[model samples]
Target chain A: MKAVYKRELNSYLNNPMGYVFLGIFVLFFSVIFCYINLYSLVSSNISYTFSYMIYAMLVLMPLLTMRLMSEEKAQKTDQLLLTAPVKASSIILGKFFAAMTLVLLALVFTLPHIVILVIQGNPGFLVTLLAYIGFILYSSVYVSIGIFISSLTENQVISAVLTFAIFMGLLALEILFVPGIQSPTLYKILSGISFASRYSDFSMGVFNLTSLVYYASAAFLFLFFTVRVTEKRRWA
Target chain B: MIEISNLTKSFGKHKVLDNITFRVGEGEVLGFLGANGAGKSTTMNIITGYLSSNEGKVLINGINILEEPEKAKKLIGYLPEQPPLYLNMTVSEYLDFVYQLKGIKLNEKAEKGEKSEKQQHIEEICEMCGITGVYKRLIGNLSKGYRQRVGLAQALIGNPEVLILDEPTVGLDPVQIIEIRNLIRELGKKHTVILSSHILSEVSAICEKVIIIHNGRIAAASVTDKLIKEFQDSNRLRLTAEGDAQELVKTVSVIYGVDSVEIDETKTNSSAAEIIIRTSKDVRGPIMSRLVEKNIGVINFGLDTVSLEDIFLKYVGGESDEGSIQERAE
Candidate 1:
């Protein structure tokens, strides 16, 4: 697992994909931070920045995870991994953690904004910490989902497009369905399952255990599915 | 140290391998000979634990591949038809990654006085595969032959006991093919080697035993020299003499042990005629003396050695619809 992780991380760092992902993410992150907090609202509430960053993730997270597994398949390099004395789960987790490490690095780039907020005006430290935690958990779910989609196809473009479409579908469910539902029971269920709604608590300075478990389990479920997909392809 | 028993595999509705079984003893070089799409790659994949078989088990040093893949796979090395290389990585980095991936552990106490064990091991493999000069270069920048050598180097890492190579010399030039064949032969001295190739001469050149696969079934299997000898029981001789075509055929047909004699119409002319004689025994002495006695000037007379191509065709040509065999023969 460590070997695969090191190789994957080195691959990402050696290629242009990692730079492009980090560049696009930091570019959008700064633009959203400047426009939402510094220029227009002049508010020190960093939670709003974290809240708006989800939109950027919908477009950029696929960049990090699209080629994770699909490139291995397309290049026929998976044969080396599969035939090695390693488990399929180890390969999946190695790639997953590598991508997550890059995501964490991108998140680290956002720390300057928090520093600027602290220097320019008073900002709640606990709320900012909670927002960072929320973003990591939120990105975990999408990263796992993107990796699951990647394992399904050998084409990187197809993997990216499918992951983007699924992210859009989930976003549409949160924005269009939860508020527009007529029945209270239906609204309760939809809101319970909605990723954005669960994230709203974190953005509002509330550490919701249910939302935490929801994201954690969702990420685990998708990673488990990715492992199963790889194993099934061997049998196939 | 490899045993495969009753292995069967199918891809959906189409069966790819049917009840195939073979074994390779320690330090033996075995060749899997077959045409394209003959389930050679499928069988190798199953043995390496890269693919699962439908109804069989592969035992690597007595450990079932499917039941204990990690332990079994640790004892084997595989090189697929297309070498699985990361183009973005240099040869050194790629080899290091594989060294780690294979989880090879060396005795630290023995190697403490010398260069690190991993470095020495990798260096030896690089030298053996002749890729030491390109160690620092990216795999993408290397030539095809270098890439192939690098692939072979990776397979040699950790000094696995069994090495399974799928068409190791495919797409190489004649010189490179011979070089790789020699390398495989050298490696076969200490490792159990199983290589697949459709070329007849390659099997005869490197492998001691040959298993001919046709349409997912074992068509024939035997020691390479014995197999060729088995098919050479009947003698064939081509005779060229300066005589009338009809006179040449009639003179050779009457000799003892000569089953039949036919005039080669293509090469036959008014001056010299070519005749092919098939016999169950050597009749060169009688045919020669009789031809000399008949005042026919003997131009060429020798035993026609039956090549492995004939044996391979005799097995696979019976039911194949492919025209490649005929084209190759011509």
Candidate 2:
């Protein structure tokens, strides 16, 4: 596991895709940070930045996770991992952590925004910490989904496009809103599945345990599916 | 030691391996010879625990691969047909990844109690494989032969007891082919090596035993020399007579052991022509005496033994029936 993690992490750090992801992430984040805090000085909150960054994540997560498993398959390098003494679960988790580490690295670069807010308007550090934590959890779910999609195909473009389509559909659930349903039970279920609704509590300074658990569960479910998909491919 | 019993595998409805079974003893080099799409790689994949067999058990030194893959896989090092390399990594980094994947360092910490020793051991392997000079070069930049050596070095990591190589010398030059064959021979002294190749001479040159797979079935499996002997055509004797070749062949065909006779018109030297006689047993005494009785002076005489090329073509060309899969009765 340690070996796979180091190799995968180095691949990202030493390759061009890692810098591209960071560039796009930093550029969009700066644009959002400027519009929210610099252009509109009325708001001193940094959580608003986290809220808008989720939109940036929809684009960034696919780039981070698209090649994670698909490249291994396309290059036939998975034979090394699969035939090694290590289990399939370890390989999947190693890749998951490697990709998550890069996403967190990109998140760490956004710390200046919080520092600027703290210096000028004195935003509470605890609220900022909770919002960042919430954002990490939310991004992890998407990372898991992206990797899961990567395992289904050997083509990186197909993996990226599929991940983008799925994430966009999820994002649309929040942006476009669900069609009006006559039943309150169906309405509650639809709203319950909306990531935007759950993340709204964190952006509004309300620390919601249910939303945290829901995000964790979703991440676990996607990771589980990824492992299963990889294992099933052996038989295939 | 490896034992595969009644293995069967299928991709959907298409069977890739059908009841195939074979074994390699410890420290023996077993060569798998087959045509393209003849289930050689599929069998290797199943034995390496990379693919699951639909039916049967693969036991590695008594431990079942399917039941305990982690433990079984620890004993086997596999080099697939393509080498399975990461192009972005340097040769050293690639080997480090393989070493880690094999978990040899962790095992060394528990079993050997030394870190410097492991480094030295890895360096020695690189030197042995002749890749020490390219250690820092990226695998992508290396030539095909270097890439193959890197692949070999990766498989040598962890000092596995069994090495499974699929077409290990397929793309190498003649010099590299001989070098790799010599290396495989050297490795066979301490490891059980199962290599698959379509090259007949490569197998006959290195392998102690050979398995010929055809159409998802084991068409023939025996000691290399024994298979060659089994496929030997009827004993053939070539003799150049100083007299009429046609009269000598007619006289040789009358012998008790002789089955048929043919005169080589192209091999005539002056008036003497080469006569090829097919017989069931050694007919040299009878043919010589008969020639003496007929006053046909023999210029040269020799027994022609069957070459491995004949045996390989006989099996791979599907001329030998499937019933020949039964072990030869010495």
Which structure among the candidates has the greatest lDDT? 1
The 10-residue segment with the lowest total lDDT in model 1 chain B: B321-330
Q: lDDT by residue for model 2 over B1-330, one digit each (tens)?
A: 899999999887777899998889999999998877789999999999989998999999999998898999999999998889999999999988898888885334434564566677788889888899999999999999888888889999989999999999977889989989999999999999999998889999999999988878998899999988776654888888897766777788888988888888889766888978888898789788888888877889887667766776776675443433332221
Tens digit of per-residue lDDT, candidate 1, span A1-236: 99999999998899999999999888998999999999988988888888898988999999989999999999888999999999999999999899999999998898899889999998898888888899999999999999999999999999999999999999998898789999999999988889998898999889999899999999999999999999999789
User: In model 1, which regions exceed 4 Å deviation?
Assistant: B107-114, B264-272, B293-299, B318-330
lDDT of 2 by residue, A1-236 (tens): 88889999999989999999999998998899999877875467788878888988888888999999999999898888899999888998899899989988998899888788877887887778888888888988999999999999999999999999999998886567665666888878988988878888887788899999999999999999999998888788
Q: In model 2, state the lDDT of residue B179.
A: 88
For model 1, the docking class works out as high
Model 1 per-residue lDDT tens digits across residues B104-160? 886534454688777889999999888999999999999988888888888899999
Q: How accurate is candidate 2 locally (lDDT)?
A: 0.87
The residue pairs found clashing in candidate 1 are none
TM-score, chain B, predicted structure 1: 0.90
